[model samples]
Target: MLDQLIENATVVDGTGAPAYAADVGIRDGRIAALVRRAPGAPADRAPDRAPDRAPGDAPRDRARTYVDGTGLVLAPGFVDPHTHYDAQLFWDPYATPSMQHGVTTVAGGNCGFTLAPLHPERPGDADYTRRMMARVEGMSLVALEEGAPWSWHSFGDYLDALEGRTAVNAGFMVGHCALRRYVMGPDAIGGRPGADQLDAMLRLFHEAMEAGAWGLSTTQSGTHADGDGQPVASRHAGPEELLALSRAVGEHQGTQIEAIVAGCLDRFSDDEIDLLVRMSAAAGRPLNWNVLTIDAAVPERVPRQLAPSERARQAGGRVVALTMPILTPMNMSLGTFCALNLIPGWGDVLGLPVPERIARLRDADVRAQLLRRAGSEEAGVFRRLAHFDRYVIGDTYAPANEGLTGRVVRDIAAERGMEPFACLVDICANDDLRTVLWPMPSDNDPASWELRRETWQHEDVLLGGSDAGAHLDRMCGAPYTTRFLGDCLRRRKLVGLEQAVRMLTDDPARLLGLRERGRIAEGWHADLVLFDPERIDAGSAVLVHDLPGDSPRLDSRAEGVVGVWVNGVRTVREDALTGAVPGTVLRSGRDTETVGTR
Candidate 1:
């Protein structure tokens, strides 16, 4: 008897193959057979024999469950190659929004930040780590303080804690920051490790791989900082130390390296590209990186960024760029630290208590300084805050400002005969800092969207970078899966459904080395998604108070996901979680095979 049967579906198969009408059979947590129907056959009627089954065997009626997948697309569940769900897995095992978007597998511990391998002697380290995440990852301090158990101290211990507590297959990469902090203590923040310290770090890295970590993740981006606004530990690493760590990944089977090189925020220098190639050469395995977005304003940006991977491949190394398929929307407010902090000297005041912050906002001298900085290049890449017209009031608490909601700051400022910055300050003050605002997305232009479609077809690029669990309060990256499906199937129609499914499934699966997954082939693990192509998309992000600490974060729900199965168990039906935690914790060599260039 079969465990389940999905009948009458147009199977996209996750192999970039043409659509076919088939009935998929599942049993014992794996795909047992794919029974394709002949032309003009009845939906419920089966052929003489099932594909990949014995010649005499027949499709049986003892199946426990059956799904009528008529007019729906069946493809392998998505594998997210980049995320920061490391801590959230402890609190929300399914990695919500992501799981709801048909993601069956996720890789966390991105940007060189993880929650393990703590130094035994460092007391109060957990709090410091929590604060660092709060600052760098946009995680709420209260949630991190209340949600994570912080029980284990080693990489293996961390994995053990998550053993059976997930509904989506999860894996983590050992973080360079945690490794440095463990071995070098206070010096990890700003100083390079000496030879002895490097050896210790390498040993720990090797230990983590042996304990089932997928690989190593690190960052050298200028934007990342600890809670106190200091550069992260990975930024201090010299090229030698980084190459040694990459070499450790090569020594271990089924492991690759993930790094955020310089120029992630803007453009990469030739030296930076060379360093990335060297790291990949040291690993002798694929090196994947987070976030390559197209700025249509600059027509050459996409080609210039892709050129680095070409250079790396010529050097006997491989580098795959991860690009998101959607225009990310971020909802922000002054009550929280956000893009507003990019205004020069604003961080000092934003970090202060509410009373002091309110006083500082009312000060003319401070306001002038802020306006100058916001308009200057010193504001870094986030200088867009100077365009106050792009900000629209979202929600407010004060009655006096009730009518201002959804109004742009520039219009309000003009009517009041005040500068945009001063006008914004006055409004927030009247509301006691409880007004929420939505900034106009700079990348939401049509040119940018078309460029992303162009970039999607690039040979060295992979679709990923959904920073799901991180940036919880400010951004929701978890919905990129469904959002991209809408782009491919409904909106832009740049790629056909089969190619898009292949990009989301087989592409990342091959990079992560997940064998027998990421496809709808018989004998593969039954991680599948049944969704209507027309209705599939990430719905609008809305604030939800579902976190453990009553902390609010933007979350999106899937529109057309009919059902999702993990290891042949229905974990989601009709876009709702089924409370079935049938996921496996993937280990480096034991559970994964080698991933390479397609």
Candidate 2:
């Protein structure tokens, strides 16, 4: 008997195929049958035999549970290729908001940040790692401290801790920062590893892979800093070290590479491009970077950003770029560390106490120096945030900001007869640097959307980079799957629903070498989503103090997601979690196949 069945639904199948009416059956946590229904057939009518089954094999009554999928679209559950749900999974096993939006599987520990492989000799390492995550990833420190018990000491132990505790299939990449700290201790910050230390690191990497790590993730981006304001351990490694580590990936099965170099946040230099090519070539695995932001204002950047992928391919390697279909909305605060801190010379000023920071903001010379540095070439992608005039005031706690909420800084500045930047500073000053600022992106033009569609169709580009579990308070990227689907169905319509579903499902799954997943076929894992095409969307993000220690985060609920399933068990019904934990812990070479470089 079938475990569950959905009758008379429009099945897209996650293959970029045309939708068809079908009755899909699930049994033993796998897709048992897909009985096709005649057009306009009633839900109660018997269906034709499933393609793979004999006549009369799949009776409608055989299903133990029946779900009416009328007026809904059923597709393979979405796979999030990039996320940081490492810590959040320990507390919120369902990986909330993401699972709510139809994501059944998530790839975590991206950008070289993982929570395990801690050194038993160094007790403070866990604390340091937690603080680094809190600082670099915008995770609430209170939540990190009070949420998961830092008990696991190895990559395998961490995976074991989460094995059956989740409602979605979770996979993790062994992170370089943690590995470096585990092997080199405090000296990992700026010192190069000796021969024995390097060999030990390689051995540990092999151990992690054998223990079910998905791959290796590392970062060399300038923006990533430890809790102490020093560069993360991975940043200090030379190119030779990076290449050596990358080469070790080829020795493991079903493993790939994810990294964030200087080019990820900015433009790639010739040397950076060469290094990326070499890393992928040596590993014989596809390398994917975090994000590739498209802006019609800077049309030239599209080709420049994608150049490495082409170069890598030419060098017998594969490099894919991850881009978001919808612009992720983010709120920034001057009182905390954020993209504002990435501005080359503004960190020292912004890092000061609230009173001191406000005093410096009030100083003309200090403000001039800060603005100059922000506008300089070194500012890179963060330069976009320097346009203080475009910032829309969000939350304000001061009486002076009573009427400023929802107003743009430029308009307010003009009304007050002051410069926009100075006006922004004064507004935050009025709130004692606690004002919430939303910098409206200038690249949401039609041209940019068109370019994004073109990029989505590019062979080397994949639709992802949600960064869901990180940046909890300032941004909510977990709901991007629903939001993008809604946009494709109703709003911009730059891509059709079939292609969009394919992008969100099969594309990333194939990239990560996930086997027998990301599609709705007989014998495949029954990870699925049913949604109302007309109403599906990510609702507005709202602040909620739901994390451990009552820490706040921005969360959004899905609008039209009717049901979500993992391993044939329904985890969400009517846009709400059902408290079912039926997910698998996906491991390398077991849950995945080794994707070739070619």
Candidate 3:
């Protein structure tokens, strides 16, 4: 008997091992036994057929729950290493999109944006945190204006606020933005920290590390901007400040690091790559460069970028470029807050009155500027947003325009003999700036996809970039685990099942230094997911209005994520929450020490 028993599961083991049938026994929030394998057999490994178990080591405690997993595959729950749920956690502790798709762990405090130990008073005391979050996370100012109960600002205090949370386990990283604001104040506005300000900021980073922040994350990219279209605090800092801040990570057990450099479209300039190398050298820790991927529709671009990433890593600069899946759903908008437009100086176009915006779009001069910006590879502007010839899939404000759903704006503009921008603005204004823009890239080509698969298989590249808990409106990358396992591993055979499981499981766990997690050995944390590897498929991306601000998020459901557990407590039962809250704030490296089978 046991507190719980998962019998006959094809255990993927999360160790890059071939799948094999075994019974997983759990009790008191830990893996108690491995249901002994056949005698003279090679431990947990088994051929196509199953292995026999040794004499029963069942506990006197009878199973409180039991499930037959005869036809299902079981693996360690996913550890989503990249996400911006710092703001969302204040409201939705479950971290929806990621957790719903079997993510049992998340890393927040990305891009140096986190709410924490403030020297100031409460919520209103540090409006900067709220404002920065509003700009970076696309969080509605009104929501933070009303929702978050901002009490403290110390890194440890922030953790106290987030501890014992109810969704999946989470880890916190010290953000560069918070550091700048805490010390440099508004001086951080232009990027460079003055001499004294730089020293103070560095000291705070070290203090945060000692207080148990997992690592440091910052962005050097211009894409990260404040509401006024200025670079976020850390984005403008020179290479020296970045390297000093990165050094803080090395002090506390050599913590992990994450960074976002500007320019998603072009390869890093020599100076940028040199900067990354210096930061890595200073920190003496591995760094996860924000992202590394090309437009899936055009396969050549990724190779161009990956070449530099590989060069950096090979140069003893431990850096890994997280690659997004082929279908990085495009969400375009002409709203006042469309963050993408900030790049080409077109951000001004968004905040204008609807009539003014429409007039400008139709202006010959404005159209020329937009055209020039759209055609430049350096801009990385998704042309689909400016090209109004797209059709509306759905809308609430205007019924007459709602029928335009599924029709391309190009076709409509051609029929009416109107310019793309004119048609776009008319529809937008007519619909109260509520139009869903979808960029359906040519289906990920099999040959190209296979090449991408090779990247996932690399010892360095972990499978991720779901961008869950952020970008609520534009993309829904949260449920990518199922697709990686189902479509890429099982369906296409691009990577072996064992290798795929390792990518989603062990690799990230190791990278994040969660010692007791992402492995299925006896006495490890019993965090697990059970599914049908053969039948696993990602559901179609659909818009769902679930955020506190009626902010819609693209949610792609998993077809076969049947059950998930955290610390042996069932969190997702039959693909829905059991209403049980067993998660906690896991400070990496520290978590294994604080809460282990010892």
Q: Can you write out model 1's per-residue Cα lDDT over 62-173, one digit (the tens) per residue?
A: 5666677778889999999988888888788888989999999999888899988877678667777888899889887888888888888889999999989899999899
Model 3 TM-score (2 dp): 0.89
- What does the lDDT come to for candidate 1? 0.84
Off by over 4 Å in 3: 36-62, 121-125, 296-300, 307-315, 381-392, 417-422, 489-493, 549-551, 592-598
TM-score of each: 0.93, 0.97, 0.89
lDDT of 2 at 321: 88
Candidate order, lDDT descending: 2, 1, 3
Q: Tell me how many clashing residue pairs each candidate has.
A: 0, 0, 15
How big is the positional error of residue 78 in model 2, measured in Å on the Cα after superposition? 0.4
TM-score sort, best first: 2, 1, 3
Write candidate 2's Cα lDDT for 1-598 as tens digits: 7778887888999899999988899999999989888776666533443533322323544776677777899999999999999999989999998999999999999999999899888899999999999988989888898889888898999999998999999999999999999999999999999999999999999899999998889999888999998999999999888989999999989999998988886678888888888999999999999799898877878898889999998998888889988889899988988788888888899999898899999998998888888877888888888888999999999998998899999999999999889999999999999999999998889999998988888999998999999999999999999999999999999989899999999999999999999999999999999999999999999999999999999999999999999999999999878999999899999999999988
Question: How does each model score on lDDT?
Answer: 0.84, 0.90, 0.71
> Local error of candidate 1 at 453, Å?
1.4
Winner on TM-score (2 vs 3): 2
